[model samples]
Target: MASEELINARHAATAGLIACASAFVYLLARGYQARRTFYRLRQQGMPMPPWNFVLGHLLAVPPIMKTLPEDTQQPDAFEALCRANEKRDADSIIYLDMWPFADPMMVICSPVLAVQACQEHDLPKPPILHAFFNPLAGGANLFTMNGPEWKRSRALFNSGFSASHILEQTSHIVDEAEVYAKILRQHARKGEIFSLDDVTCWYMMDVIGAVTLDSRLHSQQQFNPLASALRRQIRWHVLDNEWNLLIRWNPARPFVQWYNSYQMNSYIAQELDKRYAEWTEDEAATSSRSIIHLALAGYMAQQKDKPRPRMLDAAFRDWATVQIRLFLFAGHDSTSSTICYCFYLLQSHPEAMAKLRAENDVVFGTDITETAKMMREQPHLLNRLPYTTAVIKESLRLFPPASAMRGGQPGIYLQDDKGNRYPTEGTNMWILHSAVQRNPKYWPSAMEFIPERWLAEPGDPLYPVKGGWRPFEHGPRNCLGQTLAMHDVKITLVLTAREFDIKHAYDEWDRLHPTSKVKSVNGERAYQMQSGGAHPADGYPCRISLRKH
Candidate 1:
């Protein structure tokens, strides 16, 4: 009996050993495959990181937190990673292996390579980004669409933002600016330090609402649904880093699609349904038209010529709401950021602010209403204020609204003016505007807030700065609203500077937190201005002394 038991135990032990050997063999095979793939990529002259069969570069990528802080949040996970990489002078291509079945992903930083990838013909937007921005109501908006669809939709929308149309919106813009100015005046009376960001956001919200929704968003009012929704969406896209993993997994595709659709579409649908019903009942009585009316007119015109393209099944009201939402998202945060940065820089450099005020005095002396009228009557006066224009330009260079992203699928090659080719396959190349603008190679004393750089003569060392100075981006996909944004920034600054002597009450001004699209200062999200957007916590803060013009 003892001998028989020992034989059975021996057999069981042998079986266990065989099982362990099989598992080891399988792991070895996986490691071999991964190594082969890595070496193959290297042989192709592609830049990549050394691979571990299990982690690839999973351990290398930074640990992104699930919940980010409200005040000092990094813009996006990718941006945070880029900043880290820049410090290390790491290779542009990173082999990211966050999950099983994950492909070798590349992160690009070179500008020329980025331009080629963005302008590529064969690449559709990566599924991850597309899933995030694809609106639920119907067809994709300009922000998501790629290739012919993106091109066509862009052209269609381009006409609406033409110079003439922007001019037509100025009256409404000025009215809102006046409201903002009054808000700042109240803060000035209290002799309190305030955030300029908050006030400017309210101003931007009002301007975008007027131009896009033909509605007034009283940003001063607490708990405005539209404003809340706008802020929520921006936070979702800009701050939610966890979405990156889900975006990577193809199995979670349905969930991603549902989330984006539900976030914007359902709310917009409800609003549109209510608006359409009211419009149907009141169309005959109304004379003064809104932006929605203009869009409807354009749609009707398109239909009259050729059967109107049913781009999306969204009702006119829903469509209008979607457009307004996008417009607000695009215009508000960016414009407000630029405005606040301008004030911050001006406050830091009083000489520039004084020069700007002097120019304001020479252009429109001692009368706020007269200045507004003059700005309206002789808009060209805007171009003539070299120092003022320089200030605006410099501010934009420091904080551009849109960060650059390259277009194309993985495996594409991008070449520079030199015969050097970059491996751009599946690369989301970034043109870090902040990094570019601050590069010491491009601007001498690049870190200083110097508006005089723009006014330099052709032969001046600063005048010959490279392509990094672009605020509106360069080439075909550049900002169509460049003229409009410029007009708004110029007028707001001129009006604000002329009426108020601004000062930074805080010991240190905030630095911009890197985000995907919009860049903002730390700890100054919402500020209390005497009379600006509403409060700096809701915007950015700046203390002001109201000047009697």
Candidate 2:
């Protein structure tokens, strides 16, 4: 009996080893097949650069990354890589074969191809988006969801961002901008250099809370748990230009993620519950027209013939909280980065600055002090400041924060104007916003800070191409808070553009920075970095002083 049992055990062990060997062989076969397929396609006239059969683009990416500074963002590197490989006149969409480290990516380098991917095909967001955001959002939110579920969620959340609703909520944005302006004033008085990015982030958060949830976080004035946690969580989300062992191997990161999620989730839930109760109680006389309130109303309206719950249901609360957090994260991050860049660009070019101030003076009245008050009373007047709006447009053209990251599908192939088609199967699709937006073929004087491009008539060379200016992106999956974001940036510009001049203190920042002597990338001190979002390096360390009118 013992001999029979030993023989059976040996057979089982042999079977297990064979299974493992077979799996390894299968993976090797897949790798070899991927290499042959992509290389052969490229040789047959695909615009993609050659790659190593064994290492894929794993070895390729780091060498290109080495061109820019250590802190230069992946988006920035994407442009550099594309520029190195792309034919100036050819219809180009560069494909990088990143394996094991990241998913294989087919980057859309031209606005025409971008339109094909985003509009024509309307591809779903990549699974990596969900993988990256799952921890941050608690689960898949608007930015990550795809297909039928995505469509349903998108429909439910649409009413909250209607122009009418956003108009109702512009005052909240102005209110928060006033607090931000006051904080800037205090910074100005101190005559000290500080992080415009950090402070701007706080202000955006406050605005998000007020406009979205009808709550006063007062993050600018004091320490807020939600704000702190959000920062930590967001920082944790940034992929290092290197191997990123700081995050990958840190055992404490899981606890940190849990704690931060708990804090943000708890705060969002508590605030949402208050609004939920308010909606339940009144229904008709709903005093607040915040984004979060409208979203909740939208979700509730979708309940066909279901009995209304006295309290918030689990599914309702969970889904609602995730959307609210999405608003909080997306609203604050990209908008804040734009605000910093607006300051950085305006200070860099005084001609544009003069025109901006002149426009503001004409629109907001000569007394810059009253711009905030004027904006709050008549928020629609911001729409009237075409040049001011144009400056924000131009700033976004130069420094778009993020884009809709779509996954490559089996049958989808992006076709350019030249009739060139590229296969996108089994890969992640990314439209390099900087490359597409600033491509000289699309935008004349693309590298220059030209606000007039947005203002020029259709026949003119400087006029924006139809699909070129995609800072907030285009198509159905475009940014929901884009209108709000435009208004928020305009309001901040109105409040601060004339009152204070914030200039980059990069040289001083580098001198003062204890650990980082690393300053500037390709002579751009204010280059954007991929830290949670495309943000100015070192929070755009700068000195602020009162502008002499």
The best candidate in terms of TM-score: 2
Taking the tens digit of each residue's C-alpha lDDT, what string does model 2 give over 1-549? 999999999999999999999999988887777677667666867666657778766766767765676777777777777777876556757887766556677877788888878888888887787766777778879888878888887776677678877777777787788889889989999989888999999999898878777778899999998888887898776463556676567888788888999999898888778877877788874655576767676767766479887777778788877877878888898899999999999999999999999998888899876777777788778888888888999999888897657878887887777667788887788888877888877778888998987788879999888888888888888888898898888888888888888888988977776553445665678888887788998888888998887
TM-score of each: 0.71, 0.92
lDDT (tens digit, per residue) of candidate 1 on 1-549: 999999999999999999999999987776566556655655665544444655665554444332223333222343345445432332233333333333344554444444454444334555444444443223455555667857855665676577776776677777788888888889889887666666677688778777666667676544556666555444434222244565434475455544654655555555444444554467663233454555554455556666544342355545555554565666676777778778877877889888998988887776666877777676667766888889988877655554555544455666645464555553345555555565554578766667888889988877725455655666666666677787788889877887787765443334333344222332233222211111233344456897765
List runs of model 1 lying over 4 Å from the truth: 1-53, 61-106, 119-124, 134-139, 221-224, 235-291, 305-320, 457-459, 464-466, 505-542, 547-549
User: Residue-pair clashes per candidate, as listed?
Assistant: 37, 0
Candidate with top lDDT is 2
Error of 1 at 308 (Å): 11
**Which residue pairs in candidate 2 collide?**
none
